[model samples]
Target: MSLRSGSFPRTFHASLQLLLTRRFGTFWLASLLSNIGTWAQQVAQPWLMLSLGASPWLLGLDTFALGGPGLLLTLLGGVLADRADRRRLIATLQSIQMLCPLLIVGLLLHGSIQPWIIVALSLVVGVTDALSMPSFQTIVSTLVDRRQLPTGIALNTTQFNLSRILGPSLAGVLMASIGAVGAFAVSAASYLPFIAVALWILPRATVQAVAPAEGGRDGPPLAGARAVLAQPALRGAVLTVLGGSLLCSPLLTFCPVLVKTVFQADVAQFSLTVSAFGAGGLLGGLLLMAVDPARDRRPLASWAASGFAAVVLLSALNPWAWALPLLFVAGGLAMTMANASANAWLQSQAPAAIRGQTVSLFMLAMRGGTALGGLLTGLTVSAWGVREALALNGLLALLALAGVRRGWLAVPRPTLAG
Candidate 1:
């Protein structure tokens, strides 16, 4: 389960060491701040919707708005990432994203915000993210040494999870004190540093040149799907994550509904539950950071997803005062382990020529599945109730686990050229 090489650094601080060795640290810092801002907004945005008396369906629709565009536009985004200057492309898209929260802040301050307006802005941010995320994912490889790639990725996940822990807690306080306007304003400001780093700090050559695609380097956008499908390990990673996102991710997406409706909790308790999940994820990412790069992560991801499913099922059965938050922490850990492993495995196995496109497929699976799952689960919750909806998700995850155990979802031990 651990990387077994004496040549590579085997210490827990391998990822942390990378911070002092190169500019990847710079990008990571900027990205962490931006992500924190985003998470804060996420907390406030949902609470804002509930305050407007929106239904569970609307809550789910909000999540869908935040991720739905990836289903249609992410492939093109991947293509653009490989074909054009990644830095400029990502910065441009991020600029567009920054505007969404800014507009929300304006509406909030003007006292004229509605549920549809918030959802509409989320859709805009989601569209920009779908286009830019492939490039953003691909750019990490360019920021560090290839041998240190796994650690670099782990660090990236760590920062994101860390933000998840911090953002919700911060929002809880901000929402109580200065309200949603303050949270939205902070999200707007966080994007500036990242944009500056992308445009002014990172070298142009690092983000500008990409490996040419096959057949005169002008293959269709769907070419990445073909490339991924051709490899067993790659295919398994994508499918595993797809199933994980589709069945289990909704539990986290709809946590507010679970808290407010089922437990009748207030904002502080809701934020506490979210922070617990983030804490577990932080631990998972840190665990990955210490592992060797050569370890095959396929089985790890599969097992984690299975564990996550079991936790989701347990959440439905437990009505104890302390149970749900603890389960959420476990869910967060398992989910992060599954996702980060699949992501690192895919990035390592995929060829350089189509890395962006391949990553886009990963994004499509992760984000697209979440969007659809949120919508479907929302409707299920409306019809059956939160407990039944979550129980169904857990059962579905176990079914996916059955497929993995039966060799239906295989990941052959192999590596590929970059």
Candidate 2:
């Protein structure tokens, strides 16, 4: 079967059904709840900064606070994943994640809230995420049979996009009905079910044996980082992740600014824009889930890249406010499909022992790229203007596509079931 043609054999549905029937369904529900809270906080935090009289530089700094730690800490977390129990690590990190929102809530309740406080709390959340993400990616294989790994990844992206739909709209409503503090409190409360879910999951049988360090070296965490950076495929994956992040991740950060400054719309309009984007992302996720990775990887990646660049360029044209929903549709589909495809490919190609490290590298590239993109966009908005800055972003995205076409990045063929 030609992967580019999009036809799948019978085995695809059978494997997908087996995956959906297991504990994976329960896990997906829990993840959805937790992800909603995370997304709510993501929307609230930037708004909080804006309310506190922050400048564009300060706003960019806020983005850095939320993503910079992943660049600094994910590699170390990956090394730990190779050496420890991933489930336990995730549980502990989730517990730490709970503290971030609670801290924000306390500050809000006391009327001590400030931009710096939001920045500090965002740093804490980023730290926990850096530690948690790698282990989380590595653990999915343990939750389901290998044949269903792609399905599991697609479903995970689907749930996250679902949360993207729920979180921003809910945050807007909560902020209007109560206040930012109330939104933070709800976000804190959402963490409890995830904690419960983490504890309740039955431990799976260990699949891969841990290998000792080479030459019994017992060196620092940097050794594993060096090893991963040395591999050509891993390096390409990391760069691809960076490219995707630069093109896509800034939408969430800039949406409020776009709604407020460019559209001259209120909070409700902002919420609708976010929801529309999430709806598009949800559609992309479902479309990806329905397809067979072995038969769809290459063309999906190519299509997603080109589509993302095109949508970004079109969005930059500054269409009428009535066209916001269409913009969201384009942005959402481009973001989710491109990201999910890259993630699936990365996870499949990574060696079992270094899977966590490899994933961490990917996460680092993403976070780093987002941080840089947010900063640059903020500056460009202050200087050239929003439309021009967005156009520049689209141009950069097109450049990334050229890189992919030139073989600077390669998506590997998906493995088939026996």
Candidate 3:
């Protein structure tokens, strides 16, 4: 149950090499640039809703629009990833993703920025994102050595968390000074470097060749999904994601509401709070880079999920100065540790023949869980209020994930060797 075990310097050096090397480095550059814009848009999107006097339910619907399509499409996308050229498929998706924000910009400029338009545009982006999700994860594994996956995924999370620090903070400033239109423009422009890399810089050949599946029954998406769900290990990983996406993630979804209603803060304070979560996630990602989740993923994951639930519950109770740090820790435990470890652990147990399908299920589960949970959480907020909703999700996740501690602790873990 150990994919990698090593010292701090070993992990650090691997990270440096992954960033400095050719293909992975290029991927890193494009990801960094694009995520900055994405994060900026993330901030602007909710703010836009509020400016239009949207309700908390509508705000939650925005997330649903963005992630809902993945529930149905990502598994198919995963099957396609296994069958087709992932690089080309991703490049096509990138083109589609690029066009989405440009349309949003036009809406912003023309003063026709209706909520439906926002929701539709977000749906397009989300569809592309969900369809390409497994390819994106698989692409990273191809970039580094197989053994370095733990480090690679951790570093990837670190990059995103770092962008959380930089991008939202920048978006807050830009929104304060220039307005949300500029934020959309920045997001539109951010797609260029990634398109360039996907078009030319990434290797022409598909990264790896897999042997044919043992059974010819793998033809259908349903069949592949069934194979995925039948595996006990994958089931556990999916549950971890469900806990994070459903229980813990509503904290971020409800951030704008918290800032506006509870804290009575403006744009800058909102930005600072966003950055706090990112900063905490960044630290957590770095810590994950050093350790091996394969060693004791079950317990670690259970604890992270439970810890995140507790933190979210606490933050909801006391929206004070300390809430910021609590949210930061929540991001780490809920997001970085939970997701990165799940991805790594799932990949370890997944067979190469159905790797794409497995990762797709993972992607779909994560995204689907988030969308459903966001919708439920939004309704909870609408009916009961944020504190009650937060407490409910927290208590439910805690009871579900950590309640049967001995049972989960006794569950078998994936091996180090893939």
* Whole-model lDDT values for every prediction: 0.83, 0.72, 0.76
Task: Report the error of model 1 at residue 255, Å.
Answer: 0.6
lDDT of 2 by residue, 304-387 (tens): 766777776777786688787788877788778877777776666655666667677877877877877787777877787767
Instruction: Please report the TM-score between candidate 1 and the true structure.
Output: 0.94
Residue 76 lDDT in model 2? 75
In the range 232-310, model 1's lDDT, one tens digit per residue, is 7677788888888888989887888888888888888888998899998998888888777777787788898888999
Per-candidate TM equals 0.94, 0.89, 0.92
Clash tally, candidates in order: 0, 0, 0
Which candidate order results from sorting by lDDT in descending order?
Answer: 1, 3, 2
Q: Residue 112 of candidate 1: its Cα lDDT?
A: 93
**Which prediction has more favorable TM-score, 1 or 3?**
1
What's the TM for model 2? 0.89
| Cα misplacement distance, residue 149 of candidate 2 (Å) | 1.0
For candidate 1, list the clashing residue pairs, or say none. none
User: Could you list the CA RMSD of all candidates, in the order they appear?
Assistant: 2.3, 3.4, 2.8
Where model 3 places Cα greater than 4 Å from the true spot, the runs are 1-6, 201-224, 403-408, 414-418
Question: What C-alpha lDDT does candidate 2 achieve relative to the native structure?
Answer: 0.72
Model 2 alpha-carbon drift over 4 Å, by segment: 1-19, 202-208, 212-234, 408-418
Query: What does the lDDT read for residue 291 in candidate 1?
Result: 77
Best by lDDT: 1
